[model samples]
Target: MEHSDYDVVVVGAGLVGAGVAAALAGTALSIAIVERAPPPPESPAWDTRIYAISPASVRFLESVGVWQALDPARIQPVRRMDVSGDAGSRVVFSAYDAGVAALAHIVESGAIQRALWRRVGAQENAVLVCPARCASLERDGKRWRLGLEDGRSLSAGLVVGADGRDSWVRGHAGIGATLEPYGDSGVVANFATERGHDGTAFQWFRADGILAYLPLPGNNVSVVWSTPEAHARELTALDPDAFAARVAAAGNERLGRLTPLTPAAAFPLAVMEVEHLAVNGLALVGDAAHAVHPLAGQGVNLGFGDARVLAALVREREIFRAPGDPAVMRRYERARREDILAMRLVTHGLQRLFSLPGRLPAAVRNLGLNFTDEVGVLKNLLIRQALG
Candidate 1:
């Protein structure tokens, strides 16, 4: 088999993987990105799948040169967030209150991926091995040997898995994962709202589930309704007009009449945690390492954090330590443990708390929201944590 070698091999070219490659562009280590598919084609219609990029993630992307490459016209800054519980309780957060220009930036997932892909393509030390797949992975003494589906082979001191929740690399590396299905699906779609969102994001914890209206450029908004499987199926089955009507009603007509800009899609909701983040010469990043509920819109942000920390650790490793040294990889895992655990606990706890079946529970949770909102110091701390 034809063979190649690199200091690190990344088995995924999604946003997080690409970001990792871009972030390591200036490092002395050579890197290769193995992807099964090419970058997504551009479309005139806005993508329904979007992510709220946290401030820390924004700085990471900026350092990697992906942020500046994105189209500014398509990005929307979240100046404020308005969250309402099933009851009458509501909590509001403003960027100004947090002493930041914007709480977060809402951008289409495709845009970010494309921008990062472009960066990786131009990166001197990064190689894009797209339209390829890892057929098998094997341990070669102190290194990793990967066999590609295209009959090519590569060796690396370290292998990074950024292949997402159903990671192929993680499975091959003998990593086990525990998955908790929420019995729900996240229904997402784009809409042209009758009223302007005024650069504000709105969320509602309703009896059905949690719904969010993320503001977009102009009068557009992206909706993610996390509902039970049956309800999500019902929503996806509706015609465009009917779906629009149902969504508008769910938000209490907050955005007025809604006109679908794209077809609605739904994906299962689940929290997945891996047994171990790294073992020997392998490490996991992004959804491959961990996943959380989308109520907080922190999933992608967490993935970006993974890339940021892993790249930094790799860059600062001791000269004698290989990129895949167990001790070096452990540091990256340890640094991320608390942040990941805290987010999982918060998102999972909120999901369970709201799913309880009783008026008392609803009242208590709503009251908690109100109380948290009233505490300026506490809210700022929460905001700062989310910013990372």
Candidate 2:
């Protein structure tokens, strides 16, 4: 390979990376995706983990030329969202009330990434480099030089660190982050519900944690339950049938009995906030920028939103300014900082407020839910905010 300096070098070829790469493909810019792993989700199956993508995110993916490549049958649109509290405090959201056909769509994260990569691979100016690991990235005046582990070097006007939490690019670029573990573990699993979900996503606030049921295609749904690490381990370790029954019972048989379709898995829950999103000619996006709890299921959607805003700015500039210029990158950072901060604080507060060891919170929480349910305008406002 030659020492080619592309216009943009994006690290971490996950969904966010693919979005960024595909976004720049429309312009005359040269782009490269650097990753340690190849494409994932060799094929679509019941065992693949999924994500509940928002409508705005779907539109962005469509704009960048990825959504059409995804198999429509494999995706499930969420027509209704039901949220409740353990003490019988409950609130329900309908897409009809928000004047939309669906609240979100649940899709296999790997499949979407693979499909996006397929689109990105077809771009003439975009190069997909596998097993390309970044050793360090340093600012050289107006440009950033990326040194890779394969004993090769390249320089670009902009370097995007989509490398996820513990981003080496962000570290090398001198960006600091504040990370706090919420002492929660997000346990994910897929299941086949006894009855069709009718395109509804359900969530419950229990004493242990927040449990959400996102619809999958047909009679299946994806589950995300957050709780203490010990409880999460105990739950995931349960025999398949027992685990399924426990989940079904916890959710009050909303979709009836569930049979586990995928092995239960758990990842530590945390909220990470980066102090600086841009340094020199490098900027961070996706998990490299921030990671909130999975209760809201907006983590990946937020990353994709970052790609949309940042790329639009680059495409609109139409000047000699590099995509990675500090000024240009700051536009991306500033656009997303408020949204990220709001999500972080909201999720963090709810996790703590619900995790409290008392009855007062439980009582007051249900009241809060009831109040929100009563105020039609506030509920509508929240739906609009989420749409963005």
Candidate 3:
């Protein structure tokens, strides 16, 4: 068996994992990224899998040299957002009112993934270990030894798990997680609107589900409908025209008539909480660390924030401290605790609040939305926090 060594080993090459490795570009640390599958090939057509990238996340990507590489023509800036409640209550947020360039940028997942993959693959200190699988993990003195199915092994002082919700590295490292399914699945697809979205994003909290129409470049928009499992099945089963009509009607045809631009897809929705973010020589980032409701569209941003902070801490650590030093892990955990807990509580609370089976509950929630909308300072505060 061939044996290799590295200062840090990142498991999973998803957006967060690749972001972490790319962020360490000029560092002295030798990093290894273990990915089981290769990145998907780019398509000329718009992708259905879209992300609302927060402003703060953009800065992190820029620092890692991934943002500049993206095609500007393909990106859409969200200048305004409109959220409505089932009882006709609404709240609006604008970048101008918040005094920012934009609230967030709508981007395709593949573009960022491919860009990060290329960036890290070209880095002198970063090694891309694709088409690889982890077979075993064990403590080898002060370092962690990761065994591959191909009879090759690598040793690293720090093992960062960016794998995902069901993180292999985290499980092997004895980290436990709590998962609560929302009894819903997010149905996603792209559409061409008769009228352009004008760089605005729209979301509605309905009796059946939560729906969001995110603007895309040109006259296109991406939609994510977090509906009950049964409804999700029906949505995906609908023909292109039927599906587009259903989606358009749900949003009150805010963007006018719609035509499907891509096939609809669905993914189960869940909220996950990990017992610990790090233990000894192992630390976790991205979905490996936590999972939250998608209503706020902040899950990816939170993951990117984890990568940015973790990389910065590793880079600025004391000379004598290893990448996985207890102190470094402690700081990472402490710094992220509040943000993770806050988001979890907010998303979970909202999901539950609207799930209540009473007209009174609906009225109260809708009234709350209207009240919040009337408060300028409160709305601006929310925009500022979300801008991060």
Best by lDDT: 3
**Candidate 2 lowest-lDDT run of ten:** 40-49
Runs in model 2 with CA error above 4 Å? none
Q: lDDT-based ranking, best first?
A: 3, 1, 2
TM-score, candidate 2, is 0.97
lDDT of 3 by residue, 1-388 (tens): 8989999999999999999899888888999999999888999999878999999999999998999999999999999999999999999999999888999999999999999999998999999998999999999888999999999999999999999989999999999999999999999999999998999999999988899999999999999999899999999999999999999999999999999989999999999999999899889999999999999899999999999989888988636548888888999999998989988898888888877767999999899889889999888877876887
Residue 40's lDDT within candidate 3 is 83
Worst 10 residues of 3 by lDDT: 317-326
TM-score of each: 0.98, 0.97, 0.98
Looking at model 2, the pairs that clash are: 158-324
lDDT of 2 by residue, 187-232 (tens): 9998999988889899999998999999988999889999999999
The predicted structure with the larger lDDT, 1 or 3, is: 3
Please give the CA lDDT of all the candidate structures: 0.92, 0.85, 0.92
List clash counts for every candidate, in order. Answer: 0, 1, 0
How high is the lDDT of residue 305 in model 3?
91
Flag the better candidate by TM-score, 1 or 2. 1
lDDT for each residue of candidate 1 in 261-304, tens digit (9 for 90 to 100): 99999999999999988889899999999989999999999989
